[model samples]
Target: MNTPLPDVANSELSQALLPLDWVGMQGIDIPLILDEPGVDASVHARADLYVNLPMPQIKGIHMSRLYTLLDRFAEHQAVSPASLVALLELMVDSHADCHSSQSRLRLAFELLCKRPALVTEGLSGWKSYPVVIEAQWCEGRLSLDATVDVTYSSTCPCSAALSRQLLEQAFIAHFGAGPVDSNHVANWIRQNGSHATPHSQRSVARVRVHIDQDAEHLGLLNLIDLIEGALGTPVQTAVKRADEQAFARLNGENLMYVEDAARKVQQALATRFHASDVSVTHLESLHPHDAAASSSRRGTLPFQAFDKALRA
Candidate 1:
């Protein structure tokens, strides 16, 4: 028989002999079966899988092993908390030589749902909501988290106030203390009402939450509904004249700033979900940069710090 080649990963030693906090792949493009409970069809998703290396002498991790295990799991098991636990257990067992104990998975995909127009008859179009699910297993305990990005329109309260003041000034100048005739006022307003309209811009809100331990199913759809309902003016598709007019009325009635958007989402999620964090970013049309605000439920840890710690 011919001489067999030796495996360097297991037999060789590291040149520096130091352990790494995290050593694995990122941005891995793999197709996964996203089978949320109660959903009719499975969603095809892109995922990233990783594991930590805690041994000082091990040359490198078995990258292929991680990939193979993830592929098998995706092929067999539906994505859920229980499946995440099993996958992390397999990851730890696969690294017996290195004594590794941590594993992570991230999946990103667009949730496609049919949304009806504000005022349309038998007309609906698909709206895509960007979603991300992150799971981590550390020291035998597994945790799951998810985030959804919702885009809506936000009107600046300050800008609205300034616009109203300017309009009032114009009206006073035009009337000039004459007997205010209804037709004259109506004609003036019809012509000049929109001349000083408030500026509104497209805004985005990213709502993230830690799944409750006792929950049985994923809450992606529910979370999206909650945020959209609270905002009261989500971006729409399949719009006609009536729908556009309805949208304009909504913007006029529910004027809000970035801070208002964040608090609205935070409160909406807090009342229903166990733990939640909300970040609202308004792409200001009048400013060079976007305005952002972040909020969390009462007595909950700050989301920024917690997010950093989880990644670290």
Candidate 2:
């Protein structure tokens, strides 16, 4: 028996132009093997992907091609800026060959690390940290960006002061009223500490940067380290007695609010890399809403340049 294929072009009508800014698979879970310095093995990660397409297309793109490219990247690629640029180039080339015109790629994943505890001697199992890589190419030119999300604890300065005052009043009530010195008051409070607790604010810092295609790039780990150092008190994972003590000292020494966290990150990036076009967003725990700040390096190209090139 012979099977006859139906003719789909019978309707003589043109396909409607769909202006899709972005079109691709998302929430795609895949096990990735990552390679980093100080570690000579594979680490697992899951990626969410996206790509852009042009209008007047016969149908949607072949999503499997994006996954296949990502699979290859996971098996045999580094996550550094340069590696990301190359990966984006590969995505664009592959997509163009498949879908025609230009293509874009976005991969967001969490990079897990076995961080040591603040005062503990042993290491924790694992902590997932967020990372995002994005790239686009058109007319043979490519652009790339990378981002990371870090969490840390922030002690409200105003709340800390109020707690101290309430404790001091209680102390005066117990011991006959007299002017108390700061040191003596502190010592007395430590000796007889009670229910009063300082307010804790959970904060998240997100840093995104445009990659300079020509320079030797630092990997995501480096960016993570920089952000942690800037914040001065990242939440701990694995812990021992010593680690706990160190963490306490760190919190006591570096109490801050969401604003402080954002400023610190901004200053750190500006001074270290002259990162003129980077953006920082700090999610505040003290209030219901979030606070965000953006800083750009002088003379860096704007996002519109990429947009224009892509359209051309």
Candidate 3:
């Protein structure tokens, strides 16, 4: 005869009879397929699964059950707002013994996208975007959100103006108001263009948008395109001389401050998402500190949650 395994969780009771808001596992590795354009493979995600512990009498929930349920669901389903809500419901149902009425889940992954060179035809490379999806289910109501991190090049407007002034002074000092040949001036400019260079730094923008619970597909690529378009200076990969020149031109044309970048992203997101939260940071090449700005729409993103998501 075989001996039955001990059931400590079912038998034991909580020492303190108080309900907890959330209880479960964090950073569980899993595979998820996304039903979105430009994504052909499954992405690896670090997931945080939780269910509200309503019963003070219960010692703990079935943690193993949560893992297995997520594993099974991920193996078969593509991640989307409806799919996430369904998974949250399944999580709560699986922990019925713990009297769980609400569930929350977070999936963090890097989305790899192939990007073409700025000006080089037939030259493209892959760029990885940090992404996180948070979902919640309470009774019958559902909430879903998606956050993406975009990296770009930011040339400071102030720095550009100062650089121009310095170049102007250099030109006046060199020429001394004498009549100059056009060809000679052109060659001189080509040789001495670096008299001053505007300060530029690689910057990042983190944006969060509320996803409709009933939506079928996550518009991640479209959202990224909007942000890149607004910024106009997304960091490049695999470049030729022409591509580098084109990139420099774009940087010169799209000079911005952190506030300008934040507003650009806000305007881009407004065209699609009803509510958005945007945060932009410019790692200043001039100053020891980074410049940052935030744009919010009615506090759509909770501070605690946004902080945690960013860390992930």
Q: What overall lDDT goes with each candidate model?
A: 0.80, 0.64, 0.88
lDDT of 1 by residue, 16-120 (tens): 989777666666665566556433335667777777788888889888888889889878987777777788889878887787888877777787788888889
Model 3 segments more than 4 A misplaced: 299-305
Error of 1 at 49 (Å): 1.8
Which prediction has more favorable lDDT, 2 or 3? 3
Against the correct fold, how does model 1 do in TM-score? 0.88
Choose the strongest candidate by TM-score.
3
- From the highest lDDT down, the ranking of the candidates is 3, 1, 2
TM-score of 2: 0.74
Q: After superposition, how far is residue 251 of candidate 1 from its true place, in Å?
A: 1.0
The residue pairs that clash in candidate 3, if any, are none
Best by lDDT: 3
**Against the true structure, candidate 3 has what lDDT?**
0.88
lDDT of 1: 0.80
Clashes of each: 0, 15, 0
How do all models score by TM-score? Answer: 0.88, 0.74, 0.95
Which stretches of candidate 1 lie above 4 Å from their native place? 1-3, 37-44, 176-184, 298-312
lDDT at 9, model 2: 31
